[model samples]
Target: MNNDTVIVTGSKLTIDEVAQVAINGAKVGIAPEAQQKLTESREFVYELVNSNVPVYGFNTGVGANKDRKVEADYYNQFNVNMVRSHCVAVGPEASQAEVRAMIVIRLNTLLLGYTGMSPAIAYMYRDLLNHNITPVVPERGSIGEADIACLSHIALTMIGEGDAYYHGEKMPAKEALAKAGLEPIMLGPKDGLALVSSNALAAGQGALVLYELKKLIQLADMVYSFSLEAFKGNVSPLNEEINRVRRFRGQNESAAHVRKLLQDSYLWIPHIANALQDPLCFRCACHIHGAVRDSLHYLEELMDIQMNSSDDNPCVLINQNAIMSCGNFEVVNWTVAFEMLGIALSHLSRAACFRTIKLSSEHFTGLPRFLTPDPEHIIAFGTIQKPFTALDAEIRHLANPVSMDFYAVAGDIEDHCSNTPYVVQKTRKIVDNLYYILGIEAIHAAQACDLRQEKEFKLGIAGRVVHQKIREVIPFLAEDRNLTVDIANAYQLLKSGVLLHALNS
Candidate 1:
């Protein structure tokens, strides 16, 4: 575990902080003021419970049973039943880091004072993170109209009725709690609903995806720069003055970064490029990558709101002295943003695939076909195109939006959904696939660079570092025995962030 701690203020939780607590094992603490709000909201909930006022998911029932009234005497049993009934999520389970992300995110929002859950439950969330006790949460079973199906498993662990990972060992939730010197929380009114009726399953996974994408985009720029050097491609398209005219932030950022990566390279030696204009994949890479950046920025902004705001139904209003039914749990806005990101990434996948294809073609690079050092004896990158293109095809298919494809549940009372979890999951798959696609592109680019025996054919700063890094794990296609191993190594190299780190260093 890291020695650092993230203090959740209910209003200022950043995605980076989420990653720290989630992926880096940073401990979490609640701000004093936020804890005060949690206490105040719970008091107000008790006040309503005494007054016999009918509140959705409070005095009354939830969903199709909203009209059903619950006696104050039955609050504990009702809440427990609600939690037990909702544990319907199925495998494959989320990673321990992802479950940690979900817990921290939900814990942060509960501090906003809208969820009238017990303060003890809030502290349980903190304890789980600190003790490294992660609830075994399934990654599926929600149409994203709040992720209740998946999140209920988290509540189940808290109540000591489900499975959990105690310090990385699989065990019963009750046993995990005892091993950590903690006890199971008793469910109270609104506690179950507050715990399960959250988009944390989607949001937590999405945050990790976004963190990876930030690195992936940088990796994309680095690889593209190296490929540009191998192709001896024109650098005019990356000229800042030309890109600045369009005023697109993403395009301009990509163009500027590529220029920086290619600094002090022979590609800039006037008229050194092979052709007047390369294919759109090479010429407009910045534009496509820029579109992804733009989409990512949009999603990040929306995610900020999501991570900080209350997504509770029957949100408690301390100022107004009332509890109101709300659709705050609806995440269509950000869900669609994730959808747009997937589409943008599809473009990125295709561009990388095309660039890899071009690198193997003699018509584009003036090198041996398939980047073979010996045309007769070696078949370097010829059949390798099939796997990368197949991955790209899968990306294209995964990019199709599923947000609008849902049927109403709860007697049609819940008629709409964003399918946010699935959308984020699909985006994760796309990012993973891009690594292989870009990795193959790197392999081809490095081989092409080695084949160019001319002294004038030189590597830029980024190309030199990337070429050296790629060759460390994968050598030149000397005799072309087995390329699958090389492709896997390239994937690991790119996914590991070593090349990006080297370039920056």
Candidate 2:
């Protein structure tokens, strides 16, 4: 992640490495071993292309035209036509960051050297990233078996067709390539197929999500701990003994996090007057949050493998001395894993929302209704709960699984679809909604903590850190003028990692 260049190799690439190159703008190169294999593979494909043999996408037509043969003279135009004709994607443009990540993933798969693409072809991708020329990829039109429609746009960029963003200016690919001091690439033999056939667009977004989700998971834990403290809830529910007996690693980890956050708190001391037990939202925090943590472990494992694997088809096998077609393009397993993440996040968001509602209700926390300073005169946090409820509903709706929700395409040859892009995009939306929910919880929790402070109650270590940080940006709800400003500031604080840093520090 430092400024040093990342080396792509036959060895598996980690999500961390991709983050370094894509997010940090670090240069990327092909390892010597990968380069050697790339050259050999390209030579082998050229030999087959020259012969009268019919290979899918190499010497003959593609898809339903497999029986039809393409003349060697027309191969170049065939490649160009393949890229241009497939540029039918329609929707909002993906962020340049996502487009960059897609190119990086696609280039890494090519360096695996099984797709019969030359080192020259791979360098074209490297230059695209290094020079900051991003192919303008659309957000829709992919059923996700392979990112044909999306990646075909990228293929168009390579050949100086379609649109690209260069130096922050949207322009024609020919202009962008010239602006970057690069030339248009001519795809040869199987290079066009290799470029167009990939799951890079989806996989790229997944890698970024994994990186962002890590920080959010820890932030969710910190905010929930603050909620428990604000409500003066019993800490017995997070007892290590109970979690240890269950033997669920994620549950135990969640319990430990809560226990650590509650260190030096008054909640642990014996008190007879407190409620005998808290509501399910506070009591089952460990189990629900732990499931989320557990799912993340599984997701990270899948993402790491995905980041390293060759998600391609009709890959050349040099050792077997044959070009074999395959089904490595099926990424439904990863799509399902993302759905599990979405579901887990939905549960966590609902719990956070419930805790917020309970904290503001006199019947639940015995605090002033809506956490208002003066329940008799001042109207504060009254209408604030509407947005939290709305956010929770949105999160829940997006959590519905779409991994099994697509029809066949390409005349049934590419029959199945993974819907990975839609899955990832929905998961990203859930993450967005959860942040506002956390902000609302923080707003209510800070008020409850402030009210308890009036009664000589002490906050836990985690509670103190969150309260202090929120106080820095937003004062307590002394009298409500506009709560939206406060909520926005609190959300920014959460995203800024101020709360998480307390535990780490």
Candidate 3:
């Protein structure tokens, strides 16, 4: 467990902080003011409940059944039934980290006082996270208008009616809560809807994906730098003045980082190139990577809003002393941004696959074909391209837009859908696949660098560190034994952040 604690103030939680709590097991603390707001919001909800004003999902029923009335006497059971019914989400279950992310995100939004949920429910979220009692949540069955179908599993655990993980051990939610010295929450008016009706599932998972991507973009730059050195590629394209002429943020950022990584390398030596122009994969690497960064920036901006703002339907207005039905749950804006990101990552995947292919060709690198240690006897990287390209192909397929593909659900009242969860889920798959693709690319680049005998061919600061790190786990492809083991090791090296740590050190 991380000793660090993330203080949630309802409106200021960051993606990095989310990573800390979700992935690192950091304890969570709610802001005092936010807790007070929860009290006020709960009071307002009771006031409305007594008045019999028939607010949607409050005193009245929800969805197509909105015309149905919910008397105050049945508030507890109605809410419980709502939660149990929404647990229609199917397996495979979400990871413990993902469930933690969902809890924290939902907890933050509840503090905004827009959901009118009981303060006890909010505290339950804090307690669940603090105790490491992660609810077993299914990863599917959400149309993304809201993650009600999926998130209900979390509410199930809150009421001590489902399975949960307590300190990394899976057991009944009741047992987990008891072991953690906590009690099951009693659902009140609107409590069940409050617990499940939000986009937290998608938002939480998406925030993690963004965190990984931030590092991935930097890693992509680092690997590309090493590949440039191995290719003896022209540094003209990376020249600061040339990249700055266009004034694109992502391109300039990628180009500048690559330049920094390639600092003091022989690539900077004027007239060191084998040709005036390298392949587009080598020349436009930064631009392609830049496009990914640019797309990521857009998604992050939208995700920030999604995380902090109220995504509740029938949002409570404490100032106005009223509850208003609204569509704050709609997440199409960020859903499409995720779609665009998938496309951007597809381009990144293709570029990496192309770069790896170029690295193996004798025509491009002037090294023996397939980066063979002994071309006469060893058939090295020739067949290895198939795996990385297959992974890239999967990335290309995952990049296809699916946000707009949905039928009218919920008795046609919820006619539209963003499929936000699936969009974010697919983007995550794209990032994971890139790790393999880039790992293979790194393997090829390191091999090309080792095979280069030119007196002028030398690694820069980042290259030396990356090469050393790769060789530490994955040796030079000395007469190709099982490349599958090598590929797996390279993936682990990149995924483990070993190379990034070395570069930073």
Q: Give the range of the ten consecutive residues with the poorest summed lDDT in model 3.
A: 408-417
- Candidate 1 segments whose C-alpha is farther than 4 A from its true place: none
- Of models 1 and 3, which has the larger lDDT? 1
**TM-score of candidate 2 to 2 decimals:** 0.95
- Point to the candidate with the largest lDDT: 1
Ranking of predictions according to TM-score:
3, 1, 2
Write the number of the candidate with greater TM-score, choosing between 1 and 2: 1
- Better-scoring candidate (lDDT), 2 or 3: 3
Question: Residues 83-116, candidate 3, lDDT per residue (tens digit)?
Answer: 9988998888888998899999989988899999
Report residue 24 deviation for candidate 1 (angstroms): 0.8
TM-score of each: 0.99, 0.95, 0.99
Candidate 2 per-residue lDDT, tens place, 370-474, comes to 888897888888798899999899999999998887776667766678789889989988887888899889888888888874354777888888888889989
Query: What clash count does candidate 2 reach?
Result: 0
Number of the candidate with higher lDDT, 1 or 2:
1
RMSD of each: 0.8, 1.9, 0.7
Error of 1 at 254 (Å): 0.4
lDDT, candidate 1, equals 0.93
